[model samples]
Target: MGERVLVAHQPAYWPWCGYFSRLLDVDELVLLDHVQFSERGWQHRNTVADRYGRPVRLTVPVRRDFGQRLTEVRIAEPDFRERHWRTLSETYRRAPHFNRFADRLQELYAQSWTHLVDLNEAVTRLILDALDLKVTLVRTSGAPPSGTKTAALVDLCRRHQADVLRVGTGAGAYLDAGLLERAGIRIEVAAYAPTPYGRARSRPAGLSVLDLLMHEGPRARAVLMAGARTAPFTSTPREVHA
Candidate 1:
């Protein structure tokens, strides 16, 4: 098999530290948009504070009545951007450094965007473009044999002709590593270790990539790679969590 990586992650808005951690170590990142949505999760909502420095969520509306699995689910709202902006502005309007990137973030949000898939693809492309990362990004929708859970992920790797499956740290709990090894491919877990950063708030330590970007700018990529570590197999979830 050729050099490649398959990372199956649920689509998250502006993704968090762990997402970028996997991106840095892999050659290709695959979003598992077809997976089930864990409720109260990053799938349909993410946090941005109000002007008061308190957290507020920007939500993607889902069909409350739609009992279909996440693979069958689609973003139901038409006015995603407008609602996102209004909520964000109200929350971050009072934040300490809200003025710094508020306008830019807001402008991007207000653009003529439609479709959750389009929005997800656009933001993913934008963030990668901004970071100048060379990794190939693909969605599960485009991959062959889009199954669910382990079968879906394994099939993606097989379809991509990958010899090694690069999984996020915490995912080991749910993945059958032994099954993968028997299939003649290695399983590796990637970690997003904390990098030194300063923020307007005294609450230091690693946070979302937004915290890194706000504090580090272009240099953020360096921190992302160096601080994001990768390792070979372990069935225990602790090492994965590490």
Candidate 2:
């Protein structure tokens, strides 16, 4: 009934506050599950803050097939989940709101997950539910379009009937403004500026939304939206979030 806003990104593990911030005002989210797996990216790992204000990275080992899409990658280790849970418990057990979300997170880690993307999606879903963000989800792994870069994104926009594509500056190098305009989809800049919720002052402003949740609990939603905003798209910028 109104102009539709859409955001698309690969699933991330223990996503940061900014990740959920992207969904704050969008109508739909396209999980780019069909994209090639990146070994160095946040798709399978994220950082959390240690009790002593240190940054600790948690990575999930993934077995990537030759030219495998994200959806096809498998988790390489069985004990990673247990280790991660233990690490979280050790790091955040003293956090003010850890008890509020511990049971759900523990239950999540206890489940069996085979695919890397599935685990990331589950983590995303867990955070989405915790934040109470209501947005439609569409995965391209089941039927990915045949193209690379901007063209594929345009196709996804058209396919989903998205009136506008809301993305962060990191996508600018790969995104073609004219192409989106031709497709009748406008590009808007959406991003999260970190508001310190008492974490190490490092590259990733808020270690992870998980950290934010531990510290701020139900107030995280407000903290997340505090720095989140959208504007007309422009130059490429390096992403600084999990």
Candidate 3:
């Protein structure tokens, strides 16, 4: 049987291009919906260019409950969809590829959504399709994960029958690779350093994947994957968790 490779992360809002780069090759991508929600994380906010071609943030207000998991978090406002769509449409209306993806994207925003993670999945799926990535999408909400940090990650790999656990470098500093190696999971880390791509605008690098798609269109896949590198399976993590 072919080796099953997997990647997982907290589902994000209109995630930056870096989020999707490493996901391209994985057999499964798990959304960590069962994990605790992060109020200041990208889960509820992302940046894009304004009509004036400057960086602007679109934030989703959530009904805050301390210690609540992402699956339990709810959108605090009802009008955010319309407002966010307006911001996107008004800003990218003139983008070379906006017309190609505008309709479906508009329809997504038009849907009534309650859970923030559900909304995130809807958009991330669309973006993945746009990039032509065929990785199977799963969420921890389907099968509750066990443990915390690397233990949790190893449990996820075992649950999914994954032979390789390919994680983003965001967690590299804290991963307990030795634990995973002992569990018989080969660990690889994917990293992307933001580089200039066709501009949806003059906003700083690391803007949402929308910025890449609107400007680069079909070639956005290559642009998103550019400069992305994966660290080979390391017997040791950069740092060991206690």
lDDT of each: 0.64, 0.82, 0.84
Give each model a TM-score.
Answer: 0.78, 0.92, 0.91
Candidate 1 wrong stretches, greater than 4 Å: 1-3, 49-54, 69-80, 86-104, 112-114, 143-148, 200-207, 240-242
Residue 160 of model 3 has an lDDT of 88
Ranking by TM-score: 2, 3, 1
Clashing pairs in 3: none
How many pairs in model 1 have backbone atoms within 3 A of each other, for residues 3 or more apart or on separate chains, i.e. clashes? 8
> Model 3 segments beyond 4 Å from truth?
199-203, 233-242
RMSD of each: 3.6, 3.0, 3.6
Answer with 1 or 3, whichever has the higher lDDT.
3
TM-score of 3: 0.91
Evaluation by TM-score, superior candidate among 1 and 2: 2
lDDT digits (tens) for residues 190-223 of candidate 2: 7778887754434345477898888878788898
- Give per-residue CA lDDT, model 1, range 4-57, as digits (tens): 767766666766655776786566777666555566667666654333334555
Model 1, poorest ten-residue lDDT window?
A: 198-207
